[model samples]
Target: MHVGVDVGGTKVLAVELTGAGADVAVARSAQVPMPGRTAADAEVEAAVARAVADVADGRPLAGVGVSAAGLVDREGRRVRFAAHLPWRDAPVRDRLAERIGVPVVLDNDANCAARAELDAGALRGVDFALLITVGTGIGGAVVVDGHVVRGANGMAGEFGHVQVVPDGLPCECGLRGCWEQYCSGRALERVTRVALGSHLDGPEVAALARAGDPVALEAFATVGTWLGVGAAGLVSALDPERVVIGGGVSAVGDLLLEPARRALGGALQGTSHRDLPTLVPTRFGPEAGAVGAALLAAAGD
Candidate 1:
């Protein structure tokens, strides 16, 4: 059995697969709360290990793959840093392998989601594709020839850090005017909070937007415009054939995408000649990270 784990900010999600094929189905699935922000690094690692053990259920494991919510080495062995979790330059892959008794691999959560889309979800048949996952921040991946473009320092897919504004809002990455600060889930929450003196959570914001509340509609449009602006820049740079808008915020559907499509056309490098890039929603939705992580573990590379 192959196991995949998604190490998220607040929860660890794990899935087990047996006899994988087109007919593959999850044999077991589990979710455990991760160590809180104040927890130590060792405690965070232990939580992940416990989640993996529960999913494995003492069966002979084929391999274990983890999609971690932080920057990781290209070899998928080390986690450089995670803002939500208390890990910094740690050998997470090695620890998980030691505790689970299986060959373990690790990758960025965004990369894992994009890999799942590349293999079985969006960008399936496309030669060139760019994935932008808008969660707490933006997570990006560039795909060419079925392989992720891991930069020299394993930081190639951090599209959120790209500067879109010269002197804009400050970001967690110690930068100003980052694309993610304007386009991600946190951005939406921030926008919503600003719209009303009181605060509304992510679900409440989405609910209001879906119900056609004017304030919610305007907020989504504001973020969608920024999403398109960033996509336009990416289109000019990479010229990918397809672009995928995903992560938790994608549930807004056309509310987010339609404005993006409209804004992207005029911002293209050569508006008249180049074909407008195709933008689509993720096929795997929220499950992409776990599914892709599992596949990577099964591949054992």
Candidate 2:
């Protein structure tokens, strides 16, 4: 058996795998709340260890894979930085491996999500695509020639940090007007708060939208529009055949995607002359990261 851990901004999700390759299946899963933004590195690590042990349930493990939301080094041994997590130039993989008494591999959370899609989800059998995960923040990955493109420094797809708005909202990364500030789960909460004068997380806001709350509907429209606008720029540059949307925020489906499709149509240049990439949702939903990480561990990569 193997275990995969997805350490996100708000929680630590872990899954145990029962097979290898296309036969791989999630045997068990667990989650734990992550430490607050100001948490120490040891606190965050302990949370991850707890999740892994919970999912493992004392069963022996072959290896472990970690899908981290940050700029993981190419060697998968260190996390160069994480805007939402406590790690900064930290040797996370080795530390976790030591604690779990098993080999551990690490990669960017978005990269792991994309790997899952490419293996058996939306991007399967496709050559050239883009994946954008709208969670607590935005995470992106570029797939070209049937593989993810990890650019120099293995941080090619940090799309959230892209400056979409000039001197816009302040970001946790010590930047202003980042794309994530406008088009992520956090973005949804921020917009909803403005409309209803109430604070709600992504899932709560999504629940309100599903219940036909006008404030929630308006929030989705606003964030969805921004999502499309950012995608338009990426489409123009990469021209992938498809763009896959994953992560917690994508659970709303068309409520978010339809508006993004509309905005992409309007914002993309030469739309009438060029074939615009089709936008679709992930097959694995929010668990893609955990599932993909498990696959990586199964493959011993």
Candidate 3:
């Protein structure tokens, strides 16, 4: 079985994939909380190894794929940087391979998600598209001519760090007013806290929003609005045929997307002349990253 791991901001998720081609499916999965950002790179890699082992459950050998939430080098050998994690020019792929005792492939988590969508989920036959994942922070991938673009520095889709606000909010990447500061899980939590005058995590805020809490509902609106505004800029630049939204925050569905759609329609450039790109939630949701990673490993990508 091929094991794929998604190393996110708060957890390490592992999925065991079985079968081939269109028959591929996740047979089992496991997760472990991510070590704190202050932890050493070895500790974080160990957490990923543990999750992979838990999901494999002592099964026979197969290659492993890692969907890392960072700037994975174009060669997929090193994690150049990760704002929320401790990896900094770390040789993560080699280290994880050594620990797991298997051939390993690594890539940016958002790129992995885009690969999954292109392979089997949403972007199957599409020629160009943009994928934005709204988890702890934003992650993104660009598709052009049916291929994901890696850019000159292998960091083309690091859109989360885009300065949307002028010195607005501080980011872990040491930037101010990044798009993620206004449109991610962390942003949702911050907005909800400000509205309700207390702290609450992403899931808690979603729960309250589902139950029609005014503060929670408003928080989604706020974040969703920012999401659209930022996406408008990207659409203007890339002009992708479709814009897919994924990640943990997208699980709330229309509670978040509806607001985003409205804002995109209003804020987008050339509204009267250009055809607006469709903004939809991810078909595979939060699992897209891991699924894509497995596909990469299976195909030796």
Candidate 4:
């Protein structure tokens, strides 16, 4: 058996795999509360270890794969930096390997999601594909042939940071005009709050927009436009054959994709000629990360 762990800001999901790639077994999840004032790195690591132990039981795990939210290094064993977590240049793989008594592999959460999609979700059977996730932030991954493009510094496909507007909305990455600032779940909330003077979760906001809420509808349109613009930029840069979108906001479906499709057509270079890549919603949805992690672990074995 192989263990896969998708470690998110709010929770940790663990899955067992019986075969390679998409052939995943039943999954078990555990909530990981964000550490408070007194939390330390060891504490966080301990939480992860405990979660892995509970899920693994006594099955002999060939390896453990972690899909983490951060800039994982090229080595696939260390976390270079994580915006939400306390880890910076942490040897996550080694720590987990030592505690679990098995090999551990680490990957960026978005990359893992993309891999999962490619293996068994929307991008399956495609030689080249891109996975763009729109959630609290925008994340992208490119797969060429059958392998993921990790870039030279393991920071490629950061489509969120691409500058869309000059000196526009401020981003958490200490930049202005980032694509994420205008296209993410948080962006939707900000727009709705500013226009409606209220906050709504992603699905509720989309429902309101569908129900003739002008402010909510307009907010989605704006975000969709930015999403398409960013996707177009990614297409220009990577030229993938297909693009798959996933995340909470994507649950809004056509409310968001129609505008994105229009914007992509308008913004793409050579819009008048040449074939355009297909843009579709992810098949695996929220479980892509966990499934991908399981696939990675299985492959390592």
For candidate 3, report its TM-score. 0.93
Which residue pairs clash in candidate 1?
none
Best prediction by TM-score = 1
Q: In candidate 4, what are the lDDT values of residues 1-301, reduced to their tens digit?
A: 6767877766677776444445543556555565632457677777777777777786666888888878998888788987777788989999988988888888998899887887777887888888889998988788999788999988777788888899998888999999999999999999888887878887789889879888888898999998888888888977888888988898878888888999999998787787888889987677778778878877782
- Model 1: what TM-score? 0.94
lDDT of 4: 0.81
Candidate 3, lDDT over the whole model: 0.89
On lDDT, the leading prediction is: 2
Ranking by TM-score: 1, 3, 2, 4
* Count of clashes, each model: 0, 0, 0, 0
TM-score of each: 0.94, 0.92, 0.93, 0.92
Per-residue alpha-carbon lDDT of model 2 for 1-301, expressed as tens digits?
Answer: 7788999888999998665445556678999998966899989989988998898788788898899988999888999988778899999999988888899989999999889888878898889999998887889999999998888888988899899999899998899999999999989999998888889998999999999999999999999999999999999899999999988899999999999999999998888999889999998787889988988887798
Give candidate 2 regions above 4 Å deviation: 18-24
Tens-digit per-residue lDDT, 1-301, candidate 1 = 7888888888988887655444444567888998876788778778777877898787777788899888898777799988888778989988878877778989988888887787777777788889888877888888877678888878777889899999999998888999999998888888988988778877788899999999888888988899999999988888889999888888888998988898888688677877888989987677778877998888877
Candidate order, lDDT descending: 2, 3, 1, 4
**Candidate number with the higher TM-score (2 or 3):** 3
Residue 18's lDDT within candidate 2 is 64
Residue-level lDDT for 158 in candidate 4: 78
Model 2: which residue pairs collide? none
* Model with the higher TM-score, candidate 1 or 4: 1
